[model samples]
Target chain A: MKIGYLGPEASFTHHAVKGAFSDEEHVPYTTIPDCLEGLITAQIDRAVVPLENALEGSVPITVDYLYHDADVHITAELVSPIQQHLMVHPENESRWEDVGRILSHSHAIAQCHKYLYYRFRGRALETSTSTAAAAKYVSEHPEENSAAIGNSLAAHTYGLKIVEHNIHDYHFNHTRFVVLSRNPILDELRLESEAEKTTLMVTLPSDDRPGNLHQVLSAFSWRQLNLSKIESRPLKTGLGNYFFIIDVEQSFEGVLIKGAIDELEALGCTVKVLGSYKKYSIVQK
Target chain B: MKIGYLGPEASFTHHAVKGAFSDEEHVPYTTIPDCLEGLITAQIDRAVVPLENALEGSVPITVDYLYHDADVHITAELVSPIQQHLMVHPENESRWEDVGRILSHSHAIAQCHKYLYYRFRGRALETSTSTAAAAKYVSEHPEENSAAIGNSLAAHTYGLKIVEHNIHDYHFNHTRFVVLSRNPILDELRLESEAEKTTLMVTLPSDDRPGNLHQVLSAFSWRQLNLSKIESRPLKTGLGNYFFIIDVEQSFEGVLIKGAIDELEALGCTVKVLGSYKKYSIVQK
Candidate 1:
């Protein structure tokens, strides 16, 4: 089996792919769209992408692409704890004050905002395509007098030294990654012990009426189906127009899920089931 | 009266501040937190900040700050059309092929991703604190062979030449701004012709039960109180814990809105009314 992920190498997505599929052949794509496109073109069998961060909420590009650009189905989900480290070139000797710049992806920089503001008050901060790319750059150009915030895997991959470990502001930072494939996974391939989840993309009728969304939710509420998440995204047609993406904590095999969709359609909502899959949680050691 | 907005001048927030307050004494704050702090300290009578963008969804920092960090109330809302331009130093004679780098705020760069990828395929892209700051940097360092993605206001303020106008990927780009103040505006001070909106911050009972959110929404559904927007934000306590921010289509003074809140509180949810204000929409010239 082959897997595609967002990378330069040793990025969080790279870690996720390794954690979920231990011995698979993995290819790295530079951008989220590229990874999805590779999957569509059969360049890779599956693609793992970050869906949301516990601290940062959601990854907009991933969500927007899945909703608007691609015709992929989510086959499975995984959660990985994010541990960012401050790394430097192994041969360089520099104190915090001697460093002139720091580099990482924008989200990683934001996650460590408090520490960055206090320790490196006046240093220039730059963003790279990925944290591992930052590590690779620092490793290649040792004279830059810079450090990168990335994972221990990146430090090992790029031959850098870890100056500090778990430097994020919050201790409970974790990112959720979803595996997307061209076809839905078979029931026999799913792990029986894992919890089942179904995701739906819904749009209300064009009429500007009261309780339009209320009626949609009532379909699930009346059936006692639990909703795990609900988010609104702009339809991109104009301002004040939006569609809701909902996640229900149930499998699609039962009558309840199908009936709820049928009921919603009757209430003038456009509903599409994105996927029904099992969720896997991985704890990093 | 005095107003504070995110600025080094010629920013989108600056335009919002000017549009809302024509002749008021205006001050510029370096960050969103600083602008909110100015209002809390009575340094300014009111502050205007970006809440959400049509393309980008929501500004997390602004939403998080308003929810967790600051003790402020929103008094009015405004929407402004966003127009991005490709600007260069007037005296520099460089074609698109000669440009080695592009600069803008991260959101602006992301908004023009297609254009950037096609025109300057391998050029280095850098992020500044604000789009206007990128324009200023380009104007001051003409020898760097860099252009900026910003607005006409930024071009005028920094004396840069606009090489291309309206370069955003989408034509319907808009940003929503909210006015914050320490004290709520009196009902008599509001414009009667404007539409009324009441924003609420709600937290469901800590128990993990099916339909907890469903019951909360049912409170409004039964009362036929229309909701314009609903969003979930991490409470920062831990993963999977969230607080919902809801916008209703009517003022709090109405019986239906009040009854809905009473019903939600009865169901063991903590609800707070963030504001009841008039909505404003401004079109750029």
Candidate 2:
């Protein structure tokens, strides 16, 4: 099976794909929208893309594209603990202290800003398109004598040596990647999954009505459905028009889930079932 | 009284200040944290900063700073209709096509990406520190023959002429700015605020609990205290941990809102009242 990922081959997303589906054929797309677009267009059998980071919140571009443009459904969720590391090209490992610049994605750099400020005070920070891209750049230009901050997988993939492990500010950094496919996943994705979840988007009527959100939540509330997450994104229609993305902790085939969605639609809400999938956890190496 | 805003000058936040507090002294702080820092340190009586955008959702830096770092209170919310315009220095106004590059803040540029692709496809797009800064750069280097995408305030302040109005992808684009101070707002703001609001931060126990969010909403749902927004941000703890920022459309002085707060506290949830204040809307010029 061909599984595509948001990549320059060594991103956290790429690492997730490698750990979970190493035997499968892998394709890399440059952007999140391109990855999803590839799935809907049948260019790949499955696409793995970052949905949220524990520290950074939702990946807005991914969510926005899914809500506004893409017609793909999530088939499985891969949650990987993110551990940003400081690394240098193998040739520069001994003289890493002489590094003059640090390169990584903006988010990765922000995650380790304090560490950078305290230890690498005088070093310049430059943002690459992705953490993996930073790793690649450092590998290709070892003479520049710069370091890259990224995952250990990046270090291994780009033949670099990690000088520091888990330099992120918080110990709880993790990223959620969702597997998108045009049809329900049929391949035997041999991985351990502890829970099943169904995602839904509920859009309230445009007219501002008091308690409208409460009513929307009530559909699932009374059914005793446990929601793992609920987020509001603007409908892009106006100031008050919002569509709530909800994650219900249950199988999509359940009658209760179907009933709640039916009730929501009955209430003049636009409801879309974005996914019903199992959640998998990847242990950090 | 003195007011601080996220600025260079002529930023949307600065424009909001000028429109609402023409009589007060205005000070410009380069970043949101600096403005809020100025407020907490008593350097300024009030600080105005962007909170959320109708299209882009919440600004992470402002939200993160408030949640994890600042000991500030929101006093008022200023909702402004955002209208991005394509403008050029007066010298190049007639020959805009000759303009080689378009400059603006990253967010502003993303807002008009579609427009730029269709109208100015080959022109280079550069990101300035801020929209107002972009305008200043354009004004300073008219010989460069560049255009900028920013609010009307930037064009007017920089003495440029707007060639295209409302070039943003979404016509419903608006940004929500919150006024922050060390105390509740005391100055006569001299602007029309239609409704009062109370903002609360509710953090569930670290232990994952089913139906906890539903119960939290029930506290307000039963009271019929209309909610304007509910956003979840990671508590900087591990996965599945979140703190909900709820906006109750009511006054701070209300007994019912107080009852809800007590009920939440009784439920063993950590709840903090961020603010109970008014919301003002700014019309586009």
Candidate 3:
């Protein structure tokens, strides 16, 4: 089977893909939208992309695109702890401080702001398309004085040397990635999951006032449906307009889940069942 | 009166400050934290900074800093319509297509992706410290052949020509700015408000399960207290650990808000009242 991931190989998403789909053929898409578009358009059997990072919050593009464009359902979640490192072309190992510029993806760059400030103060920082791209650039441009911040995999892939290990500022630097497929997976491939989760998008009435959200929550509360995550994204129509993305800690097959969704619909909330999926911790390769 | 705003001048935050404090002395700080620091350190009378945007959800730095670092309280909210424009150095105004790079703050650049994709397909897109900085860069570097995406104020302030107006991809482009002071303002100035709002940060028990949030909402729902916004931000501790930022559409002086906060505390949830302040629509000058 073919699996797609947002990558140039050795990205954190690529690492998650490698950890989860050992037996499958991996396809790399250049961007998140392209990865999702590939899933819905059947370019690949399934697609995996990062959803949220513990320190940085949600990947806005992924969340926004899921609600606005994609016609896919999440089939699985992959959680991996992120560890950023500073790397350079091996020749720069002895004097990495002389590097004129530092490059990495914006998120990775943000994750290491403190390390960069204290260690590489006054150096120019640049954003590449991906952390792997930055690694590749450093690998190719050995004549230039530059370093890259990326994962260990990236350093190995690009034949670069790690100058600093685990340089990310925050300790709990984990990112949650999700697998998307056009239809539900029927256990065709062996994917180990620790728990089950069902995600719902709840849009309150346009004339929604304060207590309206309380009413929405009441539907699930009385039924004892456990919620794992709840987030609000812009409805994109105007200021003060929003729709909540809720994650309930159960499968959609249960009657309680149905009853709660029904109550929400009955109470004038526009409800969309995004997925009922399995959650997995990464098996680091 | 003295006011501090996140800026190098002509930024969206500066616009909000200008609209609200017509007679006050305006001071510009390079970053949000700096503005808040100025407020708390008494270097300025008050600080105005962007809290959230309509198209872009909450400003993470603003949200996280408010919850974690600043000792200031929000006194007033300023909501203003955002209109992004494409501007070029006067020399390149007639031959805008010849511009080699398009620069703006990351958020502004994201807002105009569609416009940039179609209009300046192969141009290098760069991130400046702020939108106003982008305009200033283009204005000062006329020989570099660059364009900037920013507000009309930036173009006017930098003496650049606006090649295109209202270039943001989304229509409901608005930003919510807040005034931060060491203590709550007691209507010392004539700041007209459409409504009163109280912001609370609630940290659920570590062993939180599904229905915990539902019970938390019940405290407000039963009292008929309205909530204008509800968002969950990472506690930066670990995955699955979150704190809810709840915005109630009422002042903290009321018994209803006090009752809800008290109940939440009794339920073993740590609740912090971030602010109870006036919300104002921009009195655009």
**Best-fitting candidate, scored by DockQ:** 3
Q: Candidates' DockQ values? A: 0.33, 0.30, 0.34
CA lDDT, candidate 3, residue B145: 87
* Candidate 2 lDDT by residue in tens digits, A203-272: 8876677677888877887888878788887777766678888889998889999998888888898899
lDDT (C-alpha) at residue B132 in model 1: 81
Stretches off by above 4 angstroms in model 1 are: A1-11, A21-47, A54-58, A86-110, A113-150, A154-164, A186-194, A282-285, B1-15, B21-49, B54-58, B91-94, B97-110, B113-147, B186-194
DockQ of 1: 0.33
lDDT of each: 0.78, 0.79, 0.78
Ranking of candidates on lDDT, top first: 2, 3, 1
Which scores greater on lDDT, model 1 or model 3? 3
Taking chain B only, the TM-score of every model is: 0.90, 0.94, 0.90
The C-alpha stretches of model 3 lying farther than 4 A from their native spots are: A1-11, A21-49, A54-61, A95-149, A157-159, A184-192, A207-209, A283-285, B1-50, B53-58, B92-110, B113-148, B181-192, B282-285
In order of listing, the candidates' clash counts read: 0, 0, 4
Q: Which stretches of candidate 2 lie over 4 Å from their true place?
A: A1-49, A53-61, A87-106, A116-162, A184-192, A205-209, A282-285, B1-49, B54-61, B86-110, B113-163, B184-192, B205-209, B282-285
Report the number of the highest-lDDT candidate.
2
Look at candidate 2 and give me any clashing residue pairs. Answer: none
